[model samples]
Structure formats: C-alpha cells, structure tokens
Target chain A: MTQSDLTILSNREIATSVYEMKLGGNTISIARPGQFIDLKLDGFFLRRPFSVCDLENDVLTIIYKVVGRGTEHMSSLTAGSVLDALIGLGNGYETSTSGASPLLIGGGAGVPPLFMLAKALVSQGKSVTAVLGFNTAEDVFYKGEFEGICSRVIITTADGSCGIRGLVTDALTEAGDYSYVYTCGPEQMLKAVWSKINTSGQFSFEERMGCGFGACMGCSCETLCGAKRICSDGPVLYKEEIKWPTPA
Target chain B: MADTRVTLCGITLDNPVIPASGTFGYGYEFAKLYDINCLGTFSFKGTTVLPRFGNPTPRIAETPSGMLNAVGLQNPGVDAVISYELPRLKEVFFKPVIANISGFSIDEYVQIAAVLDKEVQVGWIELNVSCPNVHGGGAAFGTTPDSAARVTGAVRRVTKKPLIVKLSPNVADIAGIAKSCECAGADAISLINTLLGMRIDIKKRSPLLANKTGGLSGRAIFPVALRMVYQVYEAVRIPIIGMGGVAGTEDVLEMMLAGATAVGIGSANLVDPFICRDIINSLPAEMDKYGISRLSDIIGGAH
Candidate 1:
C-alpha cells in the first residue's frame, strides 16, 4: 500500500445520508476492484477505510455513508481539500474465479465495491447481473451506474418502495441462475445470502479495524481456514473458508 | 551525526525506535511496505501457549486523540509463531526481535517463555502483564505487586534472554509493581501499556466497542506514560523501555529523558506504516536542533 495526499475532486450527496467522493492522485496502487483505501480524516485518531467504487487513471471514486463522526466530517469536505490516504489496502476480489455467468449482490454501502466488480466482470466477456439492496427507495443509489456497466441491474428496497420488495435475497431469487455469487453487505445479510446461494462466491466483511492493514490484529475473524485478519487477509474471504460463529 | 544507539540489557540496538507489539505484525507485513531492519527491533504480536481467535467484532473505538482496542491477543500461538511467523520475520528483519508473550496463567506464561528462550532470534522476552483485553491473567497480574512478581519470577526462571516485564498503567501504584518485578529478577521494564478506557455511543445508548471496554493508546496518553516511566525509573534500577503515545522524534527524546533506555512506537504505527522509519530518520536532525549529540546521553537526563 502507498500513502499519498489525494485532492478531493468532488464530494456530493447522492442519496439521503450517502455521498459520492472523487479523489485525484496516484491511483496506480489501486490495482484491483475490491481493494479499499484508508483515509486519515482531520480530528480522528483512526483512519477510515472505504472501498473503491470506481477508478479512472489518476482519479478514484468512493461512496461513503455518513454513519459516524469520520464520514460525517468527510461529507463536509470541499473539492479542493486534500486527504492523506493509504491506497490499495486488503486483497481485492479474485475476478478469475468468476465463470461465464456471475451474480453480484450488494446491500446499502456495500454496493460501491460491487460496482467496480461488475465492470470488471462485464469487460472480461462475462454476463453479469447486479442486485442493489437498500432500506427504502429514498436510500437507494447507483442504480443508473450499475445499469451502465452490467447486462442487467435489479434494485431491492425493504419497504416495497422500489423495484423488488423485501431484500437482496428476494432479488437474488428472481435474478435466476448464475455460476458465481459475489456479495458484500451487513453480516446478517451476507450470512443470509450465504445460506441461500448454492454457488461458490466471495464475501467482503466489514469490521471495526485498528490498522486497515495486517499490522493490527484488531479485525481478525475465525474462519474454517484459521483466524484471518479482515482488513488485510480479507475484506474479502472465500465462502468455503468462512466459519460464522453461532449467534451469541 | 548523533549517536542514536542505546543498550537494553547489554544488547545494543542501532537506534532506540522499537515498534511496540501488536502494531508491527511479525515484522514481515511492514517489511512489505519498507525495510524493517532499519529499526532497533520490534516486539512481535502478543503470543500465548494456544492459538487465540481474539474477541468479537467492533473491537476498536476511536477516541479524541487515541483509539481503544480490545484485540484480545489474537495470535497463532507460540508454536506457530516460532515455526511460521518468526522464520518469515527472519527473512526481512535480521535484527533480534523482542517476543511479547501473554498468558492466562503462570504455568502458561512459563511454558511459552521456556519455549521462546531457546530461540536464538529472540533478543528479549517482553512478558506482557499489561494486556487489558483478556479477562483473567493479563492486567490482573500487572495491577498488583504480588501477582506481577509471581509471573515475573516464574518466567524469569526459565528464560535466559533479557526478561522485560511490560507494566500496565491502570494500576494505582505503578511504581510498586515495577519495583516488585525488578526484585523478582526482571532484566528490564517497559511501561506503560494501553490505559483501560471506554466510550459510549450516544445514539445507541451502548458502549461503542463490542467488548464494552478496551486499552487506550496514542497521543492522549503520552504524559501519563512519561510520568509512569519516570516513576518506575526511580523505583527500580533496571533499564526502562518507555512507550505509550510516542509518535515523533521529540516524543522519543522526551521518553528517553524520562528514563527510557529505548522508546517504543505503538499506536503511531497504525497512523503511518512508515512512522518508526520516519522517527528514526529524523532523530539526528531533531537532536541537532535540540543541541543534543548522543541519544544515550539523554536517558534519565531530566533527573
């Protein structure tokens, strides 16, 4: 990972509490789709890790939800602001694992990384289906962006305020057969998807991390393979290796 | 150029900037980012007799100028560390690495120490009595003089390498515990480990971390660390390795002046991966600015 000062090209609200930020700098380190960047925000001790939404030469795009103080501060940043970021953290998705037909599902903020994944899958001559899940129609984002990249895009809102009602699982059932499934969302949603999906896929986990790299073992999760660091060994873990603990 | 070398228990380090345990994982991970051999040496992750899965999720919380972590000594155990991690560490870091070992019981501590003492790569055994994340043995032994000495004496019997007892700052009389460890035959002392601290989520009306509490470290705890280091230095004749909130060259010099033979860079590593390197590189320049010629000359200089 390379740490560089990235100038904010734009930080604009796209959905209710969600924002789309475009950063300009050396994007060479961000070599893969699912890799993330840790941003050192003003007045915060720990850097916030955000997944790469899209990349274009020298520019990097990330979508963040204003959940806590860090993202709240990020939402207020103007175009000219510079952010010190450790770029290209965590092992990105292994796109070679994707077969002829791949199903990509994302929930809320988890949708950002899948956007890049969908683009990569489509570019490789793979037929990709994108499913975006949100709490409501008002909270939805990137439907048009997903449509521009993937062959088909499905939007799911819990309150039946959007395309398919219920959840991403509901949309997954309607999306039909696929050779591979790649998903990222809340743990509960990811586990639900893991139980329902039959194909081998990769799941990106979100954990409270100390260092967004492997240095700090703060974000370790026990998998079938062993105790793996969620920040480095993953933000992405293969479905087979995941050992979800019995709910406490 | 100013002499940055300092000897800890007769072992001379190239510099005094040792990255604290849990921040620099096995040295190879950071070696992937930059050359780690430039460091005096780094303390490897806290290891135990058995592999640990650590605590549940949301194990970290960001405070004002620090962060609270409840990582719970997540490691692949001592055996794996010796068989796998250390061999990998040897590839990137040629310098002797400090082994930070933690356990829930005295026997467990002794067992881990006995095994690590035989390893030629281990320059020092940092017996961690200060870890606050675990329930039974960690900070419990550190808070009291008797228990601290008990663990220190037990591990000291088996280990031939320099035994540095890592002290917790959560105790009421930290000096008393340091003196006890020194009496129990500890070769040196390293203080202060992260302070026990907590934060609550206002909206959720619950603790921010899943573990409810965690050890706090970073810039917020520097003064507290310096005071404890100073106090411990007075209490014991053993050389002290000062840490907690050591971010830059200035903090390093100040820690040395506070009676640290060497200063450990902890939470700062998480902030910038190259922090230890940056601090080491800037030391000579910083010393020139402060009219100091040798770093070793400043140890307990404030006294």
Candidate 2:
C-alpha cells in the first residue's frame, strides 16, 4: 500500500528459472502471505506481480521466475538496485477460517505464496500437508521450506525426475478428508485439481493483466455467481464460486 | 487543503487524473492500494452486449517506448455488467464511474446505452468508435465521419447522460470525425484510442500478435495524440479527454495546454501504479509554479 524505492538486500538463484530476492521496502515488510507486489523492471511498460515469500522488518523476500523481459532485467540487478513496486495487493488467505489438516497444493511459481500460508497455519497449531509440483528435478524449489513447517511435505514432477512422476494429485494419499484445499498453478493443473476433488477449496488463477491492480478488467474470471476481477476481488477465489470454463 | 479539483465538460472532477478503461478494471483493484475517491473519477473496462472472450494469446506485446494490444473487447456482456460489475463498482467508488461501451453495430450501442441509462451511478458513457485492433468493426466506425456521426447519434437518443466519443489516431482527417461527433449530439470527445500497429517475430518468421495487428499506445504515441487533440479541440466545442502515453504530471500539464480537458493514463499506469496519484498530487504545485490558479485558464493556452 505504501510506495518506497527499497534497495535489494540479496538476489540469488535457487533453481532453474527461480530466484529468491530480498528488498528493503516497508510496505512489502507488512505484506500478508497471499498478497503480491507489482514490480517495475527497467525498460518494461508493465510491472510484474510477485508474491511475498517471507518478511522481517524492512526486508521483504520474494521468489520469482525469469519468465519474460521484466524478470530478465530483475535477474541482472545487483544488491544496491531500487525497485518501484505497488505492494500489498489482493486479499491473502484467511487462516482462521481454514479447518484442521488443510491440504496445500502449489505448482512452480505458485509455490512461493504457500510458504507464508504454511507458516501461518502451523503457528496456529494446525496440521498442514503440502504437495509441491515442478516440471523437472532441477526445477524444484522450496522443498526444504515447506518441510520445515508442514507435518507432511510431498514433491511431484511431470518427468519423474524427482519424487512422484505424475502430478500433485498423485500425492493425494488417504481419504478425501482435507478440511480445505488451496492451490495455484497453470490452468491445466488447476482444472485437474478442480475435477479430482469435490471438496471445498480456494483457487488462485493467473491471467494476462492490463494493470496488476483492478483498474483494467483485463484479468477477469467468470465465477458461479457472476464475473469477478482476479486482481481486485481475488487472485484467490473460493472453489464453489468458480465456474471453470469447459475446455474447447 | 489539497487543491484536488478539476472540471471537464462542465462536470466537476475531484481531481483530473483517472485510470483509463481497460487499464483500471472496475475502480476496485486500485482502491485496495489507495483511496480511489481521492482522484477525479474512474472508467471501467469496455462492455458489450455479448460476453467476448477477447483476442487470442499474445494479445499484448511491448515495443520500444510503447506497447500493442489486441484485447478484442473481452467483457461479460452489458447485461452481466449491470448485474455484476455495476453493483460492485457502486460499493467501492463514490465518484462518477464512466462506463466504456463498445459495439459491433449501431443497434448494439443503443442497447448498451439503454441499459446504462437506468443506472444513476454511471456518470458518463464513453463510446469506443475507433478501436483499431478489432477485426472489421471498430476502425471502420471511427474512420468515416458519417459512421461516427451515426453511431454517436444512435447512442445519444437512448441516454441523457454525457456522451464522450473516443477517436482513433489511424484516421487522416481526425478533425472531420471530431466535428462529426459534435454535430451528432456528443457532449464531449475523447481522442486517440490507439494507433494501428504490428510487430514481427524475427526468429519465428510470423507476426507477434495472434490478431496480426494491435493498437499501439505509450510514450511514442504522445505527439500524435497531442496533435490530434489540438485539431479536434479546434474543430469542436465539446471537451476533449486526451490520452496516449501520459506518464507524469508534466505530461498531463502538456496535454491540457494542448486542449485536453482531462487526460487518460494508459501504458503509464501499467509501468507505475502511482503515476496517476503522482500527477494528481503535483498538479497544484505545478499550477503555482506556472503562475496559474485554474487548470481551465490554460486549456489550449500553449498556442
């Protein structure tokens, strides 16, 4: 919510296409788990949105992928660089309402936000089972971070280059008794989870956005009730409210 | 007290800066970051009669000093908007919210305006007569003076609210279209929607966007936007909402001096969410420095 050009505390690559960056912005320091910051890299017209990985004091940690030009420039910056960011966006996950033994699913870029959710859940004396998905073994990230906070941490990769060869759903062992499920990933993966589990959950979708905030209706999702903007009402939506488009 | 007040088309704005349609969703998202009511007003994304899925993938591409978009007016039909977006917009923003309306036909424009006419929250209707990126439709209506007049006239009959006709920069005779909108009963004219542009993938040997063409907006389009605003201002008596590549308060001032009653922050909003606020905050000081008290006193005063 507050805009301050903070310096980079540290920027290091952890896995393929993934890097952990730390900034000194106070706005990001107070950012909740599910909230994201829109970052402006040099020479790009639009700011890129990144979720808060961790925060302490004036320092803000974010794990990001070098997917496009913006991130590519973000990757090249040194420790002294400054970033103009719109921090504290989207309503984060509500921890108090979540039931006991919540099932957490995160794929690739989606994994960063769940770290905070896991920390929040465990602090409240609740058991969390996290399933982290990546494309290949080398691409895996935050396995250690999730393991530190959760009772059970499962890892999945499509090529069998890592833990389970199939997908996050492959790691859904035991009965479908999870109190609530929270997931973020590519559309196909979300659809898979949407179909397999009839239980209630929360979903975060990625859409091409005009303004990372709600001004542009560029990133709108059709819900069961009606249409809602992902940037404003939610990048997170209750499972029941979503009307997943039938694949053409 | 902050001198955060501006008037356009005889309508008073709390401030002159606003997030352009398609950039600021429904005025709710930015409300989370800052008090949205602190500024002038907000314009919602384009609405149509039927829900449009928008253009295919690669709908947007960033070019040097600008960006291209082929969004294809993706919206949840006008009826759905009145039922869904309007109620939500009413809850979040207290200022006037301009509903941007687009259509494939003249009747569609009337139908959409009629639906909006019933909603008192809607402060104005911005007609997208010349969207260059759409296929076969928008540019056609915008390029011809007759077509622009007909569309504006049709919508004018359905609503008593202020009508602002958005112009396209692709046309050669922009003044003709501006005059046409004025004659067609338009209350005001918003100029320079986007210029028709294309990009090539040197490595892939194909066009960059799936639509093969897109509307270009950003810093590169400013001069063109200013010139068109000047011409249109001279051609018509209606107020002009100038937009192209406004990034700062200085740009806003320049746009106003060139005859823009208000300015639209397009690509600049994408780069910095605080740009609009920066312009709004610095306007009074800028006026003081220039020895001017009222923004209207300097309208087209640069010449």
Candidate 3:
C-alpha cells in the first residue's frame, strides 16, 4: 500500500445517512476491486477505513455513512480538503476467478464495493447480476448505476418502500442462474447470504480494527484454516474457507 | 551533526527508536512500506507457548489522543514465530530483532524465552510481564513487584541473552516493580506497557471492546509514561526502554531525558506506517533544532 495526501474533490450525501465522496490522488496503489482505503482524519486518533466505490483515472470514489463522529466529520467536508490516506489497503476481490456470469450481492454500505466489481465484470464481458438491499427507498443508492452495468439489477428494501419487500434473499429467486456470488454487508446479512447461496463465492467481512494493517490483530476472523487477520489477510475471503460461528 | 547511537545491554543500536511490540507485528507489514533496517529494532507481537486467537471482534476502541485495544496477546504461538515469522523478518530486517514474549505462567515464559534465545535473529528477550489485555495471564505477573521479579528471574535463568522486563503502569509503585526486576537479574526495564482503560458505545449502551477493557496507548498516555520512566530511572540501575505514546523525534528526545536509554514507538506506527523511518530520517534535523549533537549525552538529561 502507498500513503499519499488525497484532495477531496467532492463530499456529498447520496442517500439517507450515506455519502459518496470523490477524492483525487494516486490510483497507482489500487490493484484489485475490493481493496479499501484507511483515511487519517484531522482530529481523530484512529484512521477511518472505507471500501473503494470506484476509481476513474486519478479520482477515487468511496461511500461512507455518518454512523459516528469520524464519518459525521467526514460528511461536513467540502472540496479541496486534503486527507492523509493509506491507499489500496486489505486484500481486495479476485476478479479473474469470477466465472462466466457473476452474482454480485450487497446491502447498505456494502453496495459500494460491488459497483467497482460490477464495472470490472462488465469489462471482462461477463454478464453480471446485482442484488442490493437497504432499509427503505430513501436508504437506496446506486440502483441506477448498478442497473446501467449489470444484465439485471435487483433491489430489496426492508420497509417495502423500494423494489422487493424483504431482505436481498427475498429477491434471490429472480437473480436466477449465476456462476459466482460476491457479497458484503452486515454480519447477519452476510451469514444469511452464506447459507442461502449454493454457488461458490467470495465474502467481504468487517471488524473493529486496530492498525488497519496486519499488526494489531484487532480484526481477527475465524475461518476453516484457523484465525486470520481481516485487514491484511482479507476484508474478503473465499466462500469455501468460511466457518461461521455457531449460534449461541 | 547529531549522533543517534546508543548502547542497550552491550548491543549498539543505530538509533533509539524501536517499534513497540504488538504494534509492528513481525516487521512484515512495515517492510512493505519502507526499509525497516533503519529502525533500531522492533519488538515483535507478543508470542505465547501455544497459539492464541485473542479477544473477539471489536477488539479496539478510539479515545481522545489515544486508542484502547484488547488484542489479548493474539499470535501464531512460539512455534510459528520460530518457523515462519522470524524467518520472514530476517529477510527484510538486517538487524537483530527483539522478541516480546508473554505467558500465563513462569514455565511458559521460560519455555518461550529458552527457545528464542537460541535463535541468532533474536537480539534480546523482552519479558512482557504486563500485557493488560489478556485475562489471568498477561498483566497478572506485572501488577506486583514479587510476581514481576519472579518471572524475570525465571526467564533470566533460561536465556543468557539480555533480559528486558516490560512493566505495566497499572500498579501503585511502577518503580518498585522495575527495581524488583533489576534485582532479579533483568538487564533492562521497559516501562509503561499500556494503562488499562475502557470505552463505552453510547449508541449500543455497552462496552466498545469485546474484552470489556483494554490497554490504552497514544498521545494521551505520554505524560503518565514520561513520569513513570522518570520515576523508574531513579529506581533501577539497568537501562530503561521508555515507551507509551512516543510519536515524534521530540517525544523520543523527551523520553531519553526521562531516562530511556532507548525509545519505543507504538500506536504511532498504526497511524502512519512510515513514521519510524521518517523519524530516523529527520532525527538529526530535530536534534539540531534542539541544540543536541549526540543523543547518548541526553539520557536522563532532565534529571
């Protein structure tokens, strides 16, 4: 990963409590689709980690929610704000392994990373299907964007104010005949996705991290191969290697 | 020209900046960022006899000027360190690395220390008597002078290499603990291994860290660590590896004046992976600005 000062080209709220920020910096470090960036905010002690939404030339796009003080402060920023960022962090998605038809599933904040993956799959001439879930119609974002690239785009809202009235699984039957599944979302949603899909896939996981690199061991995840670090070992993991925690 | 050389336990380090244990991992991550040979030496992750998965998710929390982590000594165990980590560290780091060992009992410490002492890559065996994050193990021996001394003496018997007992600051008398380790044959004392602290997620109305509490480190702990280093300096005859929130070169120089023969950069490495390299590159200039020519002369200068 490379560290560079990125200039915030735009910071605007895209959906309810969610934002889409475009930063201008060196895209040289970003190699894969699912890799993230850890940003050092001005007054925060720990860096805020975000998945890369899109990378066009030198301008990088990221989506964040104002869940806490850090992202709230991030939402207040304007153009020309310089942020010290650790670019191209975490082991991102392995797109080459994506087969003929890829099923990209995402929920809420998890939707952003799939945008880049969708773009990648489309460029590879693979027909892509995107299943996105949100709390409501207002919480929905990038639906049109995903529709523009994928052969089919499915939207699910918990409140039924949007597309299908349920979780992304409620709309899964319509997704129909996909070769691979790539998903990122809340743990419960991810767990559901893990059990519902029969196809081989990759999953993106999140944990409270210490050093967004591999040093601190704060973001350890248990897998079939013992425990691994989520920051360096992965924010993404193969579906076969996943070992979900037994329910209490 | 500013001189940044210092001798710790008869071994000469090019500089006094050592990345604190648990912060630098096995020198693998930072090696990808910049050349790690420039660092004096970094203390690797806290290794135990058997592998530990550590605390659960949300193992960390952010506070003002600092962060709290309950990593609970998560490591690949001693065997993996010898077989995998040390070999990889050897490839990138040319200097001898410090092995920071943690254990639940005296035998565990003795076992791990004995094995590491045989490795040529290990320069010193840093006994982590004070890892506040783990339960019934890590910080247990460090909270008391007798326990700290007992662990130090046990490890000292196993390894002829210089022994540095890392002391926790959560006790009543940090100096007493340092002196006890010194009297027990410890070659040096690394003070202030994170004060136990915790945070609450108001939104969830529960503790932020999975372990409930964690060791606090960063700018917030600097003054407390400095005071403890200054206190421990007057109590122990051995050298002091002063740490706890040492970020910049000024902090390094300040730690030296507080009686640290060598300084450690911990959470700062998490903030900026290249901080140690940058500090070493700018040490001479920062020293020049302070009218100091040789860093060795400034050891306990404030005293």
Candidate of highest DockQ: 3
- Ordered from best to worst lDDT, the candidate numbers read 1, 3, 2
lDDT of 3: 0.92
Highest TM-score scorer:
3
In model 1, the clashing pairs are none
The Cα RMSD of model 3 versus the native structure comes to: 0.9
Tell me each candidate's i-RMS in Å: 0.7, 2.8, 0.8
Candidate 3 residue pairs that clash: none
Ranking the candidates on TM-score from highest down gives 3, 1, 2
Candidate 2 per-residue lDDT, tens place, B1-303, comes to 335466876689976787787777676666766777777886788888898877665566777888888878877888888888888877878877888998888998899999998898888999998877667666678888999999999999999999999888888899998998899999988878988899888879999887889888889999999888888888888888889888888888888889888888887776676678778878888878877777767778776
Task: Write candidate 1's Cα lDDT for B171-208 as tens digits.
Answer: 89999999999999999999999999999989999998
Fnat of all models, as shown = 0.87, 0.35, 0.89
Off by over 4 Å in 3: none
TM-score of 3: 0.99
Cα DockQ of the candidate 2 complex: 0.31
Candidate-wise lDDT, in order: 0.93, 0.81, 0.92
lDDT by residue (A135-165, candidate 1, tens digit) is 9999999999899878899999999999998
User: What are the runs in model 2 whose C-alpha is more than 4 Å off?
Assistant: A1-4, A28-32, A56-58, A96-98, A173-180, B1-7, B12-18, B25-44, B49-61, B74-99, B112-124, B133-138, B157-162, B198-213, B291-294
Q: Candidate 3 chain A: minimum summed lDDT over ten consecutive residues — where?
A: A239-248
**Going through the candidates in order, what is the number of backbone clashes in each?**
0, 9, 0
How many residue pairs of model 1 clash at the backbone?
0
The Cα error of candidate 3 at residue A171, in Å, is 0.7
Of 1 and 2, the candidate ranking higher by lDDT: 1
lDDT of candidate 2 over A1-248, digit per residue (tens): 65668789889999997899999866743445787878777777766788777766767789999976778888889998888877787777777767898888999998888888888888898999888999999999989878888998888999999998878988777424688888888888888888887568888877766566665555666788776767667888887888877554
